[model samples]
Target: MSSLPAPTRRSLLGGAGALGVAGALGGAVAAPAHAGPWTPARFKGAKLLAAPDRHLVGRFSYGLTPALAAQVRRRGGARRWFEWQLAPGRIPDPAVGSLRTWWSGLDRGAQELWSRQTSEIEYGWAVMEDYQRYVLLRRTRGQHQVLEVMTEFWENHLHVPVNGDAQFTHRVPYGDLVRRHALGTYEDLLRETITHPAMLVYLNQAVSTKRRPNENLARELLELHTVGRGRFTEDDVKSSARILTGWSVDLWRTWRASYQPEQHWTGPVRVMGFHDANAAADGRELTHRYLRYLARHPATAQRIARKLACKFVRDDPPQSLVDHLAGVYLAHDTAIKPVLRALVAHRAFRASAGLKVKDPGEDAVSTYRALRVAIARPPEGERGEQYAANAILWQTAALGTTPFEWPRADGQPVDSASWSSPSRMIASFELHYTMSGGWWPTAGTGYRRPGQWLPRRRIRFDVLVDHLCQQLLGRRSTATLLKACSEAVGVGRREVITREHDLVRWSMPRLLTTLLDSPYHLRK
Candidate 1:
């Protein structure tokens, strides 16, 4: 039986903020899990494919790169490139590593953060900004494109919003938890996330006791994380909570998952057909076994596959594609790589291109990559790096999604239509416009030597547009877009080159803003 918890903190129900809103509106309950695996007959039709490279880069990475495109070309095709991206361990992430040096707090243990100062709101936000910037830089610049994509997908799949002012400290470990198991077996990721202190408190499992079991974590594990809405019942939720009663974080061990037998409900419990047999003092082992069983459930396979297909394929992913991906996930016992490989190789994936629109975060990062915008602070060890990072975080927050900040656990939406509204579209254009003029408008496109980054020759308007089109979009400009861009800057078809820095400084931002707002840049 599905059940929603009464008015509490968060629900994470059906859609983004669905559960939270459900809680406020006459009480909350667990989501309605899928009755069965999705079928081809369910949706009637599937979206067809559009541009190949554009689709690949858009779906696989937050941003597109000439280097990333070239890598795919070298690998012979999108399928092989995807396979290669799956083995991110073999790929070095120097850009992310370099950013880490700037973010020293990321290395601090949970205990250190807890003891240092948990109540300082500004300080907590600063630490949170560092974590957010790490995620942003990695997505926008990291080499493991597919790995990053999966990281984002799994982060949302197992959403754990910040619990309080001090929980910002735990986000570091939480992000690590997601990244470590991002491409691994499903069981490992589930185990790691549930046991982590951040999730424990976020879902209220940390405080659950035998006297009063908190169903928050247990219910979501079934409804949101594993079997999904209809596969389990209310009794299973109660049982799952009993199984997890003693599973709390060890503040003594840097806030790691720990067990206190005194708090455990050692009596028998059952989640679906799996049972604990009421074996006293066996809660931990049963919890592990029960979770592993859930990991292997057929419903779980389909649930995870549908989510992956939703992310990588179309908004309403084809049920046929979901079934195919589910088979791969189940056959491999939920090892992530195999499921993704099947997804990349699927005909549905290749066909359903350009139909998906970009989310706010995706749009911002993609714009940065297309513009080759540098995310650096002032040179000579300027004191404003932290402020700069905070500024960028605020920028992304305005777009409606940033890392670790979704107030509810459902996370940002996956469908393109959610972000396609005219208000949001205009907000995106304003952001791109500001960045086009450099992060600070006064900085005037903010390159130490902007000319060096540009084409060496003093090119004419038409040639400049062509060069930028190739640079930013990886293709020649469409007739309509080229005409609009030229007209935006009052340039005639037969314009001539000129060596005028003043002209470039004055006009380039406007022209580049036009390019960024073009459908070519906006779509993928």
Candidate 2:
């Protein structure tokens, strides 16, 4: 990869501001007073629970489909369902055939070359496209909810940029790396990323040579990846960077090239109080041993635990929960599955109602899933190619999570501050309205049609509203929302009334957007 401009603190902060969306009407709406913490009771044996409506199920599941939600409900609720997702291998791959084909086409060498060519922005677009397609397919065809959610979790955990000119290609390889080891040990995931072309480029590790060591990757490796701020010092970062030097990628070449001993400075380096030499005289075995040592460090365990807790449990999870998870990570050798399992089983995860804010990607995937939008590859001709291109590009852009295109090295933030800006809010509203209105020309056939498609069927405005309420709010709407939607429906003309299609098409998305902008939507 060629040398790139260094990303500054100001640039990163500015990027966050640019992604923020604005406030919405009724944004002050709070969760139901008696809703209580998220628990099995929230989804217990209730007569009203009808095969997990795609809209409602999409909130918790990756994509919503009646079949997928049914599976989750049958498995006994969201807690158990989440457990299955954390165990990546256990989640059945409904679309593995195409994915396998995609992977097989690349050898190690070609894979590296591809990673080097795709810009970060394009990479973001691709990842977002894949994510959207994955949700659409599962909701419309395959009905694999657990798989989708797990894929999402793993992707965010190991996020890489896909927007730079030469960064997009790295998205697939980086994503592949994450999926491959998502259920495996965190140590393994860490080691794989150390050499992964995507991470190297995104974090500037590729430029971290002996003569002028760059601390960009090293700082993030500690702050974001392993031990967060306050856990390590600037000196520690410098030393760590030294240890990571001589590791670079060959953009023009196919597979990842080996560590160049000639490029390495065989000198002493200290990381976290541990001193070691990078000299070949000490042998590659010793250097590798040190890498493994860092992987298993107690601080790494703590950092990983905190991140998981923030993701699955709550934004500010209890200290006790963090301690317990850290212990589990260390005991299990940083096994991701066990930590996730413990989280699902713990009271923290089950009881933390409305604690998390949905990132843009999650919101889009969940919405499409709930609607049961079917996304399929085009047929094996020119038309098929066009369909594929359109599907990949439009959905990603609409959802705001195009692959490999994260604007900064830290990746997209999961909190409310970054996602809830005025502009983003407007974008969300427009996207939701357009999707609900069935405005996208390319989204064919999936839109629900009454009478002709299914006799005795009529699209009921109330039913649609009710369903969307459950999906977006995990409960029915308040009197305020219900009244607003009813008034909106009443204003439509007779032609729209007889079909109830236009009303639903217009109101559903509006209602969803309004709800998403609500304070309740910002919570878990």
Candidate 3:
């Protein structure tokens, strides 16, 4: 990517403000009237996805597709479809299964991964970049959309960025650990992730010992991961750090992780209400007990529930909803599935259509899905656009940040305002237009022809716009969308469109970009 001139606020606002995106995108898109999951859009004269179905699929999955919508309907509405998705083992995800073969470095062990960098065979950052591409590909093509969605949520919650020094060696394995327990109990997930070599090394726990207990991981485990801020004192942080001393990795050499009894700090420890004797050097059992206690703590439950609600329902979720989810979390012993069930059943979640803004990664992946872009395996060792996987990472970087690249341990912000800036919106607009026109990333990519967008040989422009609205937004065209499309393609609403018409020949991307730039696609 080349450097461009700095974006002025006036130009960005002018470019997107005309369509009411600058303000409307910061909140929910104007929602349609409330309808049952199986209700038809009688007013629009099209069998569009009911409001409930749209809200559920949009919130849980990357983006809605005609195929996905059909699957939701086939499973007897979104509620039933969600129930089936809870057990991902029954779902066959062949597309994402093959992606690992494309990026074999993802399967590399810690020792070899580090050795490759030491010997200049590959750079750590390059390997991490491959991991980013792998995740983006999964989000774009994976059939187990719910699993992918939760995997991202949990990964961000217990974040270990891929660019950490020697910890990058274990980053891939850390991600695998999170996915395995994505829908499992938080007690198990928190215990396992906090002990993983990636987390230890990233937060300096790998070097922590009885003589010197590193407080980085311990502080984050308390502040960001568990009870959150203002819940614990500095002395509690010290005790937490001492309790976490035994888990270590042979960093920068063999890169193997083990629980060394000699490295464990021995003393009394207390965090909040939980207390431990810490009499033995083998502190593994004590660590487990402590983590389980924290996972079941009221503050921790409230924090986890609020984060889930913020990510799935809305940024500032209602206190009542938060309290309800926390109760569910405790009632199920920290199991995530039951809590997710309660969340989707909540009225606020059902009514929160288009309330959340898509971050850069979500924006890119959803656009790829919306455009129905097909990706092929690239030739081995290819570079740039010659490799679709690599190109996709660059595409995300162009939008803003790549996946898991947040520098802080708290992970990326989950609020809509963080991702709703004019500059980000402008970048998204450019990406939509670029992908729509198939102007870049030509290799190993199959872009739909302009004619394929037309359902029939001849159709009125207004009807064509409605068809596109159905395809892109999963709803019928609105008066606002129709007017935008007309102005975008320089055609009257009632004008007849054909394959040879200028609108279809060279200007179709403009119309698609307009829809993509709309809040209907930008949010949720």
- Best by the TM-score measure: 3
Predicted structure 2, TM vs. truth: 0.74
Q: Write the per-residue lDDT of candidate 3 for residues 1-524, one digit (tens) a residue.
A: 11324324322322234357654467655533443321222124346679888989998999998888888988899999999999999999888878888876888889998889999998889889989988999999998899999999999999999877788999998998999999899999999999999999999999999999999999999999999999999999999999999899998789999999999999899988989889998999999999999999999999999999999988889999999999999999999999999999999998787789999999999999999999988666755436566788888888778899999999988878788877788888889888889987888899999999988898878788888888887877666666556656667766788999987888888888888888888888
Query: Residue 51 lDDT in model 2?
Result: 27
lDDT score, candidate 2: 0.54
Assess candidate 1 and give its TM-score to the true structure. Answer: 0.84
- Count of backbone clashes for each model? 12, 44, 0
Kindly give the stretch of ten consecutive residues in candidate 3 with the minimal lDDT sum.
Answer: 36-45
Model 3 residue runs over 4 Å out of place are 1-18, 31-46
Off by over 4 Å in 2: 1-60, 63-65, 86-91, 99-151, 167-170, 207-214, 253-256, 277-284, 379-401, 441-445, 450-481, 491-524
TM-score of each: 0.84, 0.74, 0.94
Give per-residue lDDT, candidate 1, residue 104. Answer: 62
Per-residue lDDT tens digits for candidate 1, residues 1-524, read 01213312111111112222212112112333442211111111112122575577667887666666677777776667777788899988877777776666678777776665554523556666777777877887788888777788888888875435545557777877898899999998998888777888778887798899999999999998899888888889999999888877654346666788888887767788787676676477777788899888889999898877777777788889988988888899879988877887788988875556667778777877876766663222334553444456666777777775777767666666666665665566677777766644232123323344346556555566666666666655444444445445545434554545443656566567666665555554
